[model samples]
Target: MADRDWSIETLHDDYRQALRIDAVHYDSNTDLQRIRVLENARFGRFMTLDGVVQTTEGDEFIYHEMMTHVPLLAHGHATRVLIIGGGDGGIAREVLRHPSVTHVTMVEIDAGVVEFCKEHLPSLSAGAFDDPRLNLVIADGAAFMRESDAEFDVIIVDSTDPIGPGEVLFTDTFYGHAQRRLRPGGILVTQNGVPFMQGDELTNTMRAFKALFGDATCYLSTIPTYAGGPMAMGWGTDGDARHVSLETLQTRYAASGLACRYYTPEVHKAAFALPGYVARLMP
Candidate 1:
């Protein structure tokens, strides 16, 4: 491929952060939306969905580890997992790291994202799709949760920012369905965008979650590629929210025996230590 300049901007009404790519590995518009696989000097291989940078080679572990390990470890023992919209497979890979996760039913709206990422951005999936535990379902996540009777011990909403197709997943209607699908003591986690830049996103999610679960909160993790202070992951469950202790996390981390670059037992506790500014955004 010839060298070409590719400029992509984050998806926000007012945010101006953008990335200039050195090379384009793949670019196409699927039935769902536009997708781009680009190589950058700083972030290396990364993919953007509908112009928003989803994940990159440099800092994906931060997002994936925090997203997966937090709720899984907090839940203590999750044999069945449901992942919504993480076509990149990073979330699934991390979920399967836990020996207790016997099955993971991943529902991605766009099959194109999965195929393209598998072919060009192979590192993101990291062979998680091939794992026998992964039951990859291509369908609208909200519809799947509403129609299916299957229950999950942990339902992870690894969705993109609430836009386009993702808009539905953030609504209260979908969240209610997700809550109903969870087994007793199960937890629901979501990708609530950067609180600094997308405060409304966090606030709205917390409102809906709090209404359904009564125990809703947000956690923080810094992903450089997201170009914000810290990204927020929405947490909700009917279970005890105060159960996440340092000792518990440490015990779970040691038992898993999986080495991770970003998720540490200590960091797990710290992620929920939201700053006052971010806390103000919560309901």
Candidate 2:
């Protein structure tokens, strides 16, 4: 067996998680960020951007499923979808599974991340890049939201943490623009960081969401790679999707026939139940 080197994730200053790298699949500086695809024993192939773990082949289904399914299924009839910053195509892969979805406009800042992930971590995308319904746009996500006249039924912001290229996506201006691009009852979901470690991140997003939308809250999902308890998925909409009955969710889930690993009708409802500590952070 070849010798392994450990890749330490420097996401948290006080605590860090290290993954054993069996081999380096791809490592280079992309136009926007430093991207690395590493092979690991337990997590399989994983991708990191700027020394932070983005996704892995092993547990990608958990994050992708929750991020895409919760909002789409709750909305019950989301045909047009807008995805910002999901370069790995994992969110698109899950969104396309619903046959009701007609068009998917995926605006990614770095085309290199899409191309590299498609080659190195193909399973995460699982042929999503080749889908005809997907209209891939290479542009800044915040800029697209500001300038485009197009609207969507659901907008999923599959972004990185509030730093680097993704910093713009977390701003109040970006959230306001995203709300404007949504069709009347449209839902917006964002990748908020783990509340345990990044409490301020969730708080700032909630504050923005509350000011912009009628229903602003977050749901939780635990991904092993992400570390520090459960990660929060920000939810915002002026519509009643957040109040959709469990029976309604079950009907929608059954009709879609989605085979999800982490997201189910029951889990979807339970995810919205925030712990006291996390709820205190919300505006």
Candidate 3:
């Protein structure tokens, strides 16, 4: 009998993780990047873009919930939200959970990522695509931020690592444009990769954020599929949302009626407390 195929992710030069493939659900090259959907016993179904593990069914809730809920709940009232590069729809699914969010503009550079994920990884999105509040726009996220005069109370950057198509999203120019698109007191959260393995990524983004916003720091969440150590979610805003008291967060969490597996008021507060290594990386 032949050995099962393996999907190896080489995000780091010194380390790599391989998933023994139970099945090959989808594998093809989209115009923007190569997309692969593989099934594994441990992770269920996971999707990768350009050979990088984007999200997995086993622990996606951790990333999505933290990325979406922290900023929205901190802001206290975020009706209009913008999501840049979350084609897999995990972020959108989490964002729509907030009843106060009436509008969500999700811009993806690759339409193929959305279409394939809808077809292959339905569980990740649930029914976010059908949600009327979502305004799906197929365009470059950086360009959209620059061109659109529309303002958002919260903006979530659910991008892949700063490579290939996702590189531009981490630039200072893009961050500046996103800051301009934000309403006063609005929050911008970003996926800043795992700090232990990608220290430069965190440092570069924090430097850009520090220049762009009054409050610029990062929060941590551990996702197994992402490899390395704890991943950092970049937080930036002129508002005092990051300093929202624990009592306020608890009140908001209870009022939200959100049953989350990983994200709790306590976890939200603790996530922002950076370790010395991570703190040193911050500008």
Candidate 4:
């Protein structure tokens, strides 16, 4: 196999992680960002946006399953869901697994990423886009939530790191808007970066979450493609969601009958048990 290297510009440091690719299937400058799809022997087919690996066929289940299941299972009866910035459709695929989810409104800022992923990264989405319950909205996510009168049972911010187009989603004002758009007992989850390298990202999001929801916490998940220690995910809600019992989680897990590769009921309960270094990042 020939050597085709790809470099990722992570958020915290100047150094970039290089990936060895076997070949490039698609590489284009979209309206919003530069997107690339490559086949690798180790990682399989992977997609990157602006030099950041968004998802790979090999380990995508870890991030997608944990990010979607932890909050949904905790909420117990989330019938409606809102996803912001998951243009790759990995989050939507997981969210649709729950039979209780009747409607999913996905707000993505760029249509290019979605189209590209649908064409080149088909396994990542797994036909989730064609689901009848999905409502695809091509617009700015922050602005879309601010203008909409609808409320969701769960709101998930599956955003990129706090930079470029994804920077505004991490703002306090955007959090407030999301809070207002949620039902009284609704849960809100966000993708905070790796705490070891992006401590400020977790802390800053915790500050915003604290201001809006009294019960705000974070959970951890290990993803090999992320290239750091365990990744942190933001969890916030007004009710007793973060304190859900293991029995309740197990009950919900059994009721859903969703077989996941990375997210087990026990793992959902334990992901909240953060390490000392990561716990210190919590506000």
Candidate 5:
């Protein structure tokens, strides 16, 4: 991928690759507006409900791996993992990358997204749905946290932004629930949103995260389809902050771990080094 800088502006590298062929309006489904799937010459085909490009066919691994592997490796031994709001099965694919990870329980609100992925996105999901290591549950992520007695080594909140169906997932209540759902040593991570475009919301979300988790950190990456060129991730822990060492990730995440275009070790470590504006939000 050669960095490509991964921006939202460039012509060939930008998100304006291909066009949608057909769109349907279904009310029995979701209130998320402008929901439609697209077929692209470059990106192959993808399902995008409510105008939010759920997962692009071309670069699903970039987002999914960064979201899943960073925390899993950061925690050092993430044998048991939980995913909230990632119905596409991409995060689950990355979670299973760790041989130590015995199982993953995916709590998703939209069962339709799963069906869509199973039907169209097998390449991106890489059969994570059929893996014995996964337990797919159709339920609200926040509600699942409230009732879950399971203790996970890591919890990755692969949620969309705070609005429409994905609103409650960003609340402090959900963060508190996530804390309870984790073991004492468990680490929590989430996609925080675009820093450049949704700046205030990003800061506020970090604040909500800080209130519940003992330690919290925010980071950024470039995801073209999102609001701005830069997207973000939040790292929180039930216990104190722990640094991910070189030795810890030597086995699982290497210089060129798996097939990834965007997330590199340098990018992985540098993502957490926030700017002055974003850093002020932390404790």
Candidate 6:
């Protein structure tokens, strides 16, 4: 089995463990359009059924921030937000950072993941686990999108890799459905995943998004957990806002007093800078 194949080969890296504690994924498969959860421990390593450690130190935020913030900032007037997956609650936590945002509806298929996050990883989720502004609905995001008439200002697809619960969210039909769920001038952002394992996956996703939305872009952010490499994202909307200048954003996005290790408007602008392989696929 591929899980055993991966198990035998996956080397231990400091990236997946903490404090003599480690996690491992014993087995994983999607059924009924949901990623099944399983947990395992090996040689002091703790792993999830998804074959990755469930840890507070995980770099899920770096990708979630870049995926959600860049587009929300670009719009500069987003109020209502929708996040698919992210039952871990990081995206919902970040979405509230924008003063412009009034509410966020997070639709995730796995109630177990949501429960675990609230119980165990409050620090990583930053107490937004039970924020009044957040509505955490445990349901399939695609079905919710189909029945959803309430349009959002921005929608962030914060799913796992395509193989598991998120396969539908990656398809052209889902993109089409997302476009329909958005307001006339709404933006969509997605965690398109590691650019290394699947060459040109970013570009291909961008191509599909472009066909659905007039404006589309792919961006990169360094995430330490995913395959020991950087992660990529896809963004699309009808119109582009004049970018918020770095100097202006410093004061605008809460306390110019604090600093972010990875996100700067300058970084946000540069994130769109793709390598030769990804850039060539753009129309």
Whole-model lDDT per candidate: 0.89, 0.95, 0.93, 0.89, 0.71, 0.68
Worst 10 residues of 1 by lDDT: 1-10
TM-score of each: 0.96, 0.98, 0.98, 0.96, 0.84, 0.80
Q: Which ten residues in a row have the lowest lDDT in candidate 2?
A: 1-10
In candidate 1, list every pair of residues with a backbone clash: none
Residues 88-144, candidate 2, lDDT per residue (tens digit)? 999999999999999999999999999998889889889998999999999999999
| Of 1 and 6, the candidate ranking higher by TM-score | 1
Error of 5 at 192 (Å): 1.3
Q: Candidate 2, 55: how far from true, in Å?
A: 0.3
Among the numbered candidates, top lDDT falls to: 2
- Which ranges in model 6 have alpha carbons more than 4 Å from their true place? 1-49, 53-58, 242-244, 254-259
Q: Count the backbone clashes (under 3 Å) in each candidate.
A: 0, 0, 0, 0, 2, 8
**Residue 210 displacement (Å), model 5:** 1.9
Which 10-residue span in candidate 4 carries the lowest summed lDDT? 1-10
Which lDDT tens digits does candidate 1 get at residues 1-283? Answer: 3223655574666766656688889989987798999888888988988778888988998999999999999999889999999999999999998999999999999989999989998988889999999999999999998999999999999998888899999899999999999999999999998899899999999999889986889889999988768999999898984367889888888999979998898888888889999999988
Q: Give the alpha carbon lDDT tens digit for every residue of 1-283 in model 6.
A: 2333233212233333222222332334444432222222422222243444333334555765787778777777788999998877778877877767888999989786776556555555688866788888889988998888888999999876666567778888888889998886788988876665544556667778878887787788886555646677888888764355766655555542325556778788888878876666565
Candidate 3: misplaced stretches above 4 Å?
1-4
Lowest summed lDDT across 10 adjacent residues in model 6 is found at 38-47
State the displacement of the C-alpha of residue 174, model 2, in Å, after optimal TM-score superposition.
Answer: 0.2
lDDT by residue (tens digit), candidate 4, 1-283: 2323654455446656667777799999977788989877899988888888888899999999998999899899999999998999999999999999999999999999999899988987889999999999999998997899999999999998888899999999999999999998999999998888788999999999999997998999999888779999999899898788999988889899898898988898889999999888887
lDDT-wise, the better of 3 and 6 is 3
TM-score of 3: 0.98
